[model samples]
Target: MGRGLPGSISGGVKRRGLPGAAKEERIVVLETENAALHLKLAEYQGLAGRSTSEVLQLYSAHGQQQKLQRTSVVTQLHGTVKRLKQDLKRLRSFVLELSKDFQRQSKTYLYQILTAVQGIQLENEAMQMFQIKAFDLEQSLQEVTERYEKEKQKRRALHNSLVELRGNIRVHCRIRPLLPFDAASGHSISEDRQRNFPEKVAYAADDETVLIKCSRPGHASINRTFQFERVYNALESQDIVFADVAPLLTSLLDGYNVCIMAYGQTGSGKTYTMLGPQLEENFAFSIEDESELGIIPRATQEVFRLLSEKPPGSYWVEVSVVEVYNNEIFDLLAKDNYGKVFGVKREVVTTREGKSDVPLLMHETVENAAEFLHLVNKGVQLRVRHPTLVHAHSSRSHLVVTLTINTIISGDNFGTSWEDEQTSQRLNKEVSCTFPQKMRENKSTSSSRASSPTQLEATEKLKKVKTRLQLVDLAGSECVGMSGVTGAALRETSYINRSLSALADVLGAIAEQRSHVPYRNSKLTHLLQDSLGGDAKLLVMLCISPDQKYLTESMQTLGFGTRARQVQRGQLKKKNFPVPSKAK
Candidate 1:
């Protein structure tokens, strides 16, 4: 192979040289191919090593992730165990508090139960004692009831006798203390008027008599004694004065139309006796002052007190206040939006039944004493008053405070039934005709008399059991020159004097039993015709000044009252109505 290599190398050198050259070239080509292959293999080996290193890194990362997950689970378990321990501690504390509160409440409830049981036992014992006492009281009440009935009957009989004793038209005299001006006679004097001129003209001799000494201007002095139902002195308390008049109010409740009239000269105590002393406008009268109250206030209190004693719904009372000024009837209780007097005139009309009524009169229903006094004050403020020489607050009108008391009584009662029957008899007598047979036959049915007993009974059934309590405060009569009143006030004085004179004439006519009563002469006389002529209980309170200067006016007042007392109104007939059986 060497020879061949050498010789061939020589021969081959030429041939092999070509082949060797070819071989060399092929080797070179092969070497180049091998070098290229080695380069490719090295590139592949580098890629494989890079891939192995990445796989190992991924395995290490997975191991580290597992360890971190184990650590997180262990930490979460530790926190959960800590929270459970805290909840256990709070639950133990709440249980301890609940046990303590339960025990405290149980003890309190036990004490309350024991106390209630004891109280029930005591109440049971007391109830048994009450039952025993009630039996004893029942027997005592029966005996007491029998005695009460007897006493009540005796009281009724005595009341009837007293009513007979007090005449229909009762006259009382009141002598006012001498005013300063009355004593002075409007003349200056060194000493006080009351002390200098001691009342020597008028004196109360006894409870029922008044002695008057009158010195005429040109005639001789005259001493006169006047008889009256009562004579109140200057020093008499208001309570004492009211005591005599209190009986009349009781008669009013007995269903009699009662009229109390105050008449006097100017500056006399007519207003003072009827109302109290003059006060500021709208000043309320209070029960706190018992001594200061006059007849109107005292009568109001007494009426309300008596009414309270009666059963509720037995009586309904309506009050109306009107003033007769200048022959015109004016409402004193009518008010405007501002509570001032409305100053509206009311008409005085005589009903077909011969009863005088102030049409459209304002009637106030009073519930209690305060409300009545309030209305009284309101009316007093609305009264027309003017200052005069004789009196500071001289009233210029005749104020009539009428209390219409409508009583609903049971007809089943004996007294009420008897009264109803008597009223029927009286009505029959009043309706008896004195006309001739021809006049009676010619009379129309509308004008015919209700002579039948059945018709009279029917009439009685329709009649309201109402009685009026009229408290009249007549404006005092004044001397035109002495009063120093001019203009409208002078005119008022004229009207007042005229009305008073007409009243005197009417009274004189009634006392003399004249056919013409003269009641229609003046508005005042006509308005008072019922009280003056009818069978109504009338009380004339004559107020006079105990002064020498007022002797003439005082004598006139006494004469008028004396005439009124002589008026023989047969008897005061109580208003009676037949009560329905259903009402009873």
Candidate 2:
């Protein structure tokens, strides 16, 4: 039964299996389609992942390029901004400088405009006043001219008289105050006058006399009165002494040779009188006290002042300084820094015109007193000085300063309208060669012969005047023992004494009126031959000390001065060029 049932079921199942098989086939097809879709989805998923990676890489590169471009643009903008800021700074600096320049220019223009306006207003006012005062000014000028003419005549006459009377060789005596060293050694010089004049052995009697009293062993008080041209007491100041010397400088300007010399014993005041104490160290004429200036400085100042009183360029002043040490001539101006004098020994030569001059001597041209003082100071610095027991600073040589003055006068109408007898003689001699000139109408008459007015006027322009001034500071005479000198100093002392003795001998010969004066005995005398013999005006300043120890030396100096005063020379005449007439 089971087999029959299985077959029937199988037959029925076949009918149902056909449908079931078709259902299975449909299910398999559906599974196959699903598998194919899965495969395609896997392929699509791999492609999508690779494409996503590539897209991500391309987006990163694009972002990098955009960043680079933006960076470049920003850098350019920054550079442009920086250049603009620099240009702005330059423009601001230029504007500031232009503003400053404009401010300065405006201030200057304002000042100039104000000044011009004020000047124009003042000129208009001055023009109105000028016309009103013209007549009064003319009258005043006429009155001044008349007064000037009268004063001119008087000045000319006074100048002539001074020239005549001031020609004598005068001797003056000056006594210095007692020094500290001299006071320390207080010895009774006079037993009688110890109470009143303890150290005053020599006393000034008057303006021209000095009384000296000395105690002798046997004889009663030896009283002697020495007469000089002038005597100054110890209390007298330097200015008072220079008052007597100032007129000599004026005589020099009038064309006369003037020589002023100082002579004294050692430790007296020779250098102080000639040149102030240590003035070379100061090197200035503008001293705190003008009265302290010595004769040389005073004379130089007066010379410059007088030169300024006249026209400029009318005179030329030249100065030279020389020193004589141990009978040797040395140019103090010609020296090196080491105090060694340069060049060969200068010889005093007498020119054909009978004038004495040292050849090759250095002459420095000086304009004012300051320049002259500087030059003189330079020469003084080169001078030899030695400290001695008698004087702390003693000049070891004779210093001579010479001033040569050359003057040019345009015409005879310069200050003087009339001609004197000497002028007429000089003019006549000069004009005789060039123009036909006759002698004076009368030989006895001092009046000049009147030449043709035209010829007289023509010759007036050829006048020139020259004069020489010498300032000599002689070495102080010293006693060898008192000066505490030996060796080379002793030899120098001997030469100095010898030269002084020769000078005294020359003066003695002149006083005795000898035919041949012993001027060639020493270089000093030989150099002073012109000043001693001719019409050269000479002045001797005898400086003495009030110290009792120098009584003997002072007496000797007085005696020497007395002998010098006896020397007589010809009348001094002004040196001037002869008027030249028109050449034929």
Candidate 3:
């Protein structure tokens, strides 16, 4: 019975084992299916990756083809640009040739017309003078007999007395003190008290005055004294000077040479008055407004304003700025090494009228105040400067800026019909009568005369018109002891004093009406000879300090002013001297 039970239990165990084995086999088959799926998925993924790579390669090949096409287009464009550049070069050459040809033809026509007109005009004038003289003689002969008997008796009764007289009318301008910046407060201190005040506590009248005071700490005390004569307040004084000189400037537009100069002692606001006190705020001043206009800027504005009012092509204005350093002339507009000093030689050209002093041309065009200031600032940078006990940034030399005005009157008749017709008829009749048909008919004779080098040159000379206007700023005359100058400054001081003394001598001689005034004694006097004693309308600004400390110097300055006032060049009129064409 135990054996039979064991066999049945074993069979039962076998049966359980068989089901477990079948479950394991099913698990294995599922596992095998999972592996097969994974392998198929891997194979599919590999094929997809290959397809993507092929597509990427095709895209890359397309990009390369596009790049090649773009390169070809760029190359063609470069070639076209090169050809266009060549064409532009040719066009420039052609334009230059055309300009040269136009200039030459214009000059030739001008010369021919001028020669014919001048000759006829001269002959007509001579004939008119002759006829007038002949008529006057005829009238005189008729009256001679009647007056001869009465004149004899009157001459016998006349008493013999010789009287010679000379006199001059001196025009002086006493510019009133400008309104104080703080006039609203009315708490201004006396000049004496202001001088004694502490450095920082010292009150300045305006922004520019404050900048000037700060620029040279030591000179502030002395500068405060001169407030009455020449105010450091650029906001006030510069505009006033422009107003004062407006009349003289107006005459400049009428073909007259005008010179405006600033003369004073060192540290006496010469630079401040002429160039304005150095301050960034001063640039805010505009040329359009008189309240903000400076000397140079205002002058340029006035000139252009007048130019605009004049008939077009009737006038042209050119500007040049030059500096005189150590009695030597230097062209401020010249180009040179960044820091090197470049100078130009002055040439004395002899003209038909007389010997003329012609400075080297440094032509510049100034359209506005800002442009003018830029050129002036560039010039200021190039100007010689040094530190001194009196002024931290003292001007080492004098600077002069000249504006040359050239005006041409086109002989083209712009007058009314009556005047034009009259002139035309008169000109035609005069031309025919003076030349005679015989002369006109002889082509060889006319050609020979026209082709003559001297005649052609003279004819060319008379065709154009030119005028000059000069604005000069003289260096301040300084005393060594007052300036506390030494070494190089001492030498400069000596040159300055000597030149100023020479200037004083020239003024004295002019006052005395000496026939032989020594103008060549110094370069300053020589350069200013025409403006001082010649036809130029001169305005001498006698800068003085009101402080008691400068009383003696102020007195001397006033005395100089008095002497300057005594000098006169008579009732001088503008003289348009004939210039040789080749002089330039």
TM-score, prediction 3: 0.50
Candidate 1 vs 3: which has more TM-score? 1
TM-score of 2: 0.59
lDDT of 2 by residue, 272-325 (tens): 888776644533233456777789988988888876754444455777788888
Q: Tell me how far candidate 1 lies from the true structure as C-alpha RMSD in angstroms.
A: 19.2
Q: Across residues 403-458, which tens digit of lDDT does each residue of candidate 1 receive? A: 76655443434244433555445433433322223322322111122346765564
> Each candidate's TM vs. the true structure?
0.60, 0.59, 0.50
* lDDT for each residue of candidate 3 in 1-584, tens digit (9 for 90 to 100): 32354446546656777676765665556556666777898899999999899999999999999999999999999999999999999999999999999999999999999998999999999999999999899889878956974674354223100000122222222222322221221123334323432222123353112211233334433332222222233234566666656756666654446766666655555565556545433322233444544466677667666556543333334455566666665666665567443545453232455434554445555444455566666666666666554455667777767665544332453222322445446444433433323334421111111235644453342223445566665666765655567788788777777777788898888888888887777766766666666556665665444333333444455566667756665654464432212221
Deviation (Å) of 455 in candidate 1: 23
Model 1 segments beyond 4 Å from truth? Answer: 1-168, 187-199, 214-219, 281-288, 336-341, 410-463, 577-584
Q: What is the lDDT of residue 216 in candidate 1?
A: 48
The worst-scoring run of ten residues by lDDT in candidate 3 lies at 159-168
